[model samples]
Target: MAPSTTLYPRATLKKIVKAHSNRPLTKNVDILVFLNYTLFLQELMKEASIKSKQSGERGISARSVRRVREHCLRKFKG
Candidate 1:
């Protein structure tokens, strides 16, 4: 199973689901379309990584970028 879905509170999750109910992620659909294209996620993630690196942010790491990119790609392709 997936991690506990408590990432968001029950109410907030409900709102998010109900609000985008029409465009909800289908069982077989990749979640990239939850916004638009998967590449957008890749680019944004890269940009955030660059920003954190420049700012000397301590916690963020390059592995996060690769993980997010791969997750998005896999979700979209499969």
Candidate 2:
């Protein structure tokens, strides 16, 4: 088990995994998947916010998110 930051509920995460997977996930795999998802979202949003600022936007917009999305994914792939 991970230290429970609990950004999202465990049951919700498990449901998502179940919906996609052919086999059941282990408890640790569930936590790891959820953690990675949250981290990716966090990084994506952070990059989008910065992109918005650079373009003189007041806040993150869909366009800003779209622009920075590939860059954020590349960071994760490394």
Candidate 3:
């Protein structure tokens, strides 16, 4: 039989739900899905940026990282 699938990986969805558990209820499932996608992209960008700095290659700008960080903080803050 095929393994069961979820909208997101179990751990990722748990982390997302746990992170937002104390926040206001303005966000719905659709918004949560978007947040998950954005957060994943942000993490990828951050890692790439870090690797680029280490390898002496230009990745995303520091300002862009800062903006994403702040946006995440705002979204997840209780």
Candidate 4:
């Protein structure tokens, strides 16, 4: 029998589904979701599609990234 080859933790299971899709995501939401949920690229795509509008893309800075990362790590890092 072969051992499982998955590398990501179970907390990241949602991401595998996301990445399977070929559609790409905008960078703004990409950073936000990753900073907050460590979710897969596809989940970020779903989030952005629902939340974003015709505007080019949201501007996200390093400070905001750090803040979100901290919040996720503290709140959802379980």
What TM-score does each of the candidates earn? 0.32, 0.65, 0.39, 0.27
Tell me which residue pairs clash in candidate 2: none
List clashing residue pairs in candidate 3: none
RMSD (CA, angstroms), candidate 4:
15.2
- Superposition TM-score, candidate 2 onto the true structure: 0.65
lDDT of 4 by residue, 1-78 (tens): 788784345435346535765566453544455445545434444444433433334654344444345444454544
- In candidate 2, position 28 carries an lDDT of 77
| Candidate 1, 1-78: lDDT as tens digits | 779954335455445665766675544233423434546666657665776677677656666565466555665563
Model 4, residue 21: C-alpha shift (Å): 31
Off by over 4 Å in 4: 1-37, 40-58
Considering TM-score, where higher is better, how would the candidates rank from best to worst? 2, 3, 1, 4
What is the TM-score of candidate 3? 0.39
Best by lDDT: 2
Query: What shift in Å separates residue 23 of candidate 2 from its native position after superposition?
Result: 10
The TM-score between candidate 1 and the true structure equals 0.32
Model 2 lDDT per residue over 37-70, tens place: 7899999999899999999999999999999999
Angstrom error at residue 27, model 4: 33
**Alpha-carbon deviation at 7 in model 4, angstroms:** 9.2
Candidate order, lDDT descending: 2, 3, 1, 4
